[model samples]
Target: MIKLPSAFRTLLGWLPALAVLVFAGMALAQSFQTQIYDPTTRKWVDYTPRAAAKFYNRHGQSPEEFRRQVVPFRTAEKPGTIIIDGDRHFLYLVQPNFQAIRYGIGVGRDGFGWAGIVKIGRMQEWPTWTPPPEMIARDPESAKWANGMPGGPDNPLGARAMYLYVGNKDSIYRIHGTNQPWTIGLNISSGCIRLNNEDVSDLYSRVEVGAKVIVLMQGAALYKGV
Candidate 1:
């Protein structure tokens, strides 16, 4: 039998430990890397500030909940229609071939949901927010903004807003972006539909003025042709 050299045996003995340290280092590096899917480009992009991602992932709403994907949704509405399923917290942009670009949304809280067919009467980028008289009455703190709040990152409306109107009358409801992206997929709005900043921007670009928006309430009939 051949005897191994002492030095060689010592190096071989340390190999397992070295391997573990290397693997641990690799995992630690990967832990800091985070990515999110961009539905607009249909690709994954790096998400900055890993801490925010970790917090969002841990609290509620899986990462997949924010991803916009082409889903198999059979709606009688024709292409170019927007169907908001508030109960399901999903907004479906009807597409060709019985498919839709499904977007997770933040809808009105209990006793605040609405159902109706309205048109996209107007669109605004970085729109000012004015608390209605009733809203200000309920929350006096909002009275400071009674005049109006300028649009910005801190604004309740994140990026874009599409106003809903019924036959040339403002419905006082909107499909708009939210500063609190974590609110997406949650019931926490005051009778408006909320989308992530990126999502609302995307929807705003796709949906033109005068587009039909059908908001569904509990026990509402699904869209059936026209």
Candidate 2:
């Protein structure tokens, strides 16, 4: 048996409580904010998309070409576009009783799969990335937040965010902005649909909260990678 001296015993008694404090401190040490790193200009820009900010050179996009290569808008086929062949990874925005706008996208991994028709429930500029609890649970080193992350360059949501919901139910899937312009037509997200910042901005201007989004399975998926 270990005999404890009075002063020594009191100190040992505090050890358990001390350990708790240390662990608590570590958990609270995590910090997060919107950070920007402009690779081209060599200056960091705010994530917020504003009129004053030009993300890139705006070149003319021919309506015919846009309707052709971008989104075919199904000449005389479906009423709404489809994001078919997620395994192939492409998102199609359908025109009402007309053609479909086709844009390549990066989809979620195996288990995070999603499907069906949703709408652009909400849109935001320079959106923040308050990773979901499940996402943080998967990667704790991330900028963690309980509520939501603020809009900034550092945010994973990039320059814009499109919330996807069914009626009033949040499917947790989003068609949002991406800093990686190269991955515009690649496979890289969890379940969320992705688009280059430039492309997303264009889509944002065109699509509204009530606009329809069809995530389908395309037979052929091909896109140019930058």
> After TM-score superposition, what is the CA distance of residue 21 in candidate 1 from its true location, in Å?
63
* Runs in model 1 lying further than 4 Å from the true structure: 1-62, 219-226
What's each prediction's TM-score? 0.70, 0.58
* Candidate 2 lDDT over residue span 116-226, tens digit each: 666667888888677767668888876356577787766678788888866765555688876554443334566688766666676677666766666553321111110
User: Relative to the true structure, how large is the alpha-carbon lDDT of every model?
Assistant: 0.75, 0.55
TM accuracy, model 1: 0.70
Best by lDDT: 1
Per-candidate clashes, comma-separated:
0, 18
Task: State the displacement of the C-alpha of residue 178, model 2, in Å, after optimal TM-score superposition.
Answer: 1.4
